[model samples]
Target: MNAPAYAHPQATHTVPLGGARVAYLLVRSRRRSIGLEVGASGLTIRAPLRVSVAQIESALQEKAQWVLDKLAASALRVQQTPQVDWGQGAQLPYLGGLLTLQLHPAAPRGCELLAVGEGRWVLHVPLPVDALPASVRGQVHAWWLRHARLLLTQRLQRFAPDLGVQWRSLRLTNARTRWGSAKHDGGIMLNWRLLHFRLPVLDYVVVHELSHLRVMDHSPRFWAVVASVCPDYTRLRAELRQQPIPEWDL
Candidate 1:
């Protein structure tokens, strides 16, 4: 269940985001909230353990104007993202590379990369022109994620055995704020959109999460571990922060 939200126990802090007076509806729980995060996508009202719904809404109302404005801005950004046809000649970003669509009426209603160009790749799909964008995007995202995951696995497998660490499973994540995370049981969560970044950025993220196997927090020791494994990680680390994921409909 989504945890009930309440007034942040201590006090409320306010900040301005995008010329709007953004406020925090701090809802405290035994589990530190995922936290109030406003981004270009929208708002994610994270629920904390043992919080009250009334409090969350109360806070929501208190900042309704800010919420609406930010959400509207998010909507505009999404609107501004031009859409493409499901047919041939669609342009999409893939792993810091460009993918052009080449719709060929073949296969049992699935998709695949038809071929590669000198600096671009082609995604082939046999879907109707009016096909649902959500379904089309989901398929493309899944295909690329599978490919990226395979490559990521290949890279990490070489490093993991040396550290006596192994990942239980690998899956695509759609989280807005986090690029990757590691579980105590050796599970790893990675944003599928990481495929949009350059190789160094992707490597840094993979190493960052893998380093969590030894240390869980963003402490000095964790950085040391990350650096020890992936030297020149500092530059890539900064790059990941500055590089924004390209948003696609889904």
Candidate 2:
């Protein structure tokens, strides 16, 4: 009899552990210990410069259950994530509600927001219904980017005064791993994908980054500052992590 064989589609390194195939990227760095991170891209293993393959595999075998659990969760997340369609009646998350996409050929070449009903809004794209999906997606993406900057800026301004912090500049980022980050120099970069979340979740991130201006680390003092303004931040932060953003090819 032959043993079962497993394949890794996008893995740089493959190993067999606990009757399963584990695919990971092995990175040799100056670190002292083996660090593992599993994300949408799969597992990544960072090991010390002098670690041998046998040592690395031994470490992975020890953490096989944790690695498999993370991989399973990542797969589940990918499977449950909604994909965006660039056409009429397409719905997406916006400010704690649904934003539907509508096409109006005679409108114009740009996109506009229309209030359709309570807690509902329609994005009126100037393209015809027959427009290419890529074209429609590009136009809608541009609109989202423009509005993201404006909305994020407004929130930052609103919270900075309350937090007693001064922001030097803001950059809209497309980062996959981090929602927001702040530099010691008062520059903040926020992921535009945050538009997928509700306003409270968005505000939490805003207040979080601004608080870093006073305390650059995530120590007790920094969290105290965040709680000073957003007392329910703990809940909001968890919700932000649980809410899945729609996947877009564009």
The list of candidate 1 runs beyond 4 A from truth reads 1-20, 25-87, 107-109, 128-135, 162-164
Write down the TM-score of every candidate: 0.67, 0.79
- lDDT, model 2: 0.85
lDDT of 2 by residue, 131-205 (tens): 888988898999999999999999999999999999999999986656899998999999998988889999999
Residue by residue across 58-95, what tens digits does model 1's lDDT show?
Answer: 66666766676656655565566555554447777666
Model 1 / residue 20 / CA error / Å: 5.0
**Best prediction by TM-score:** 2
> What would you estimate as the lDDT of candidate 1?
0.66
Write out the backbone clash pairs for model 2: none
How accurate locally is residue 104 in candidate 1, as Cα lDDT from 0 to 100? 49
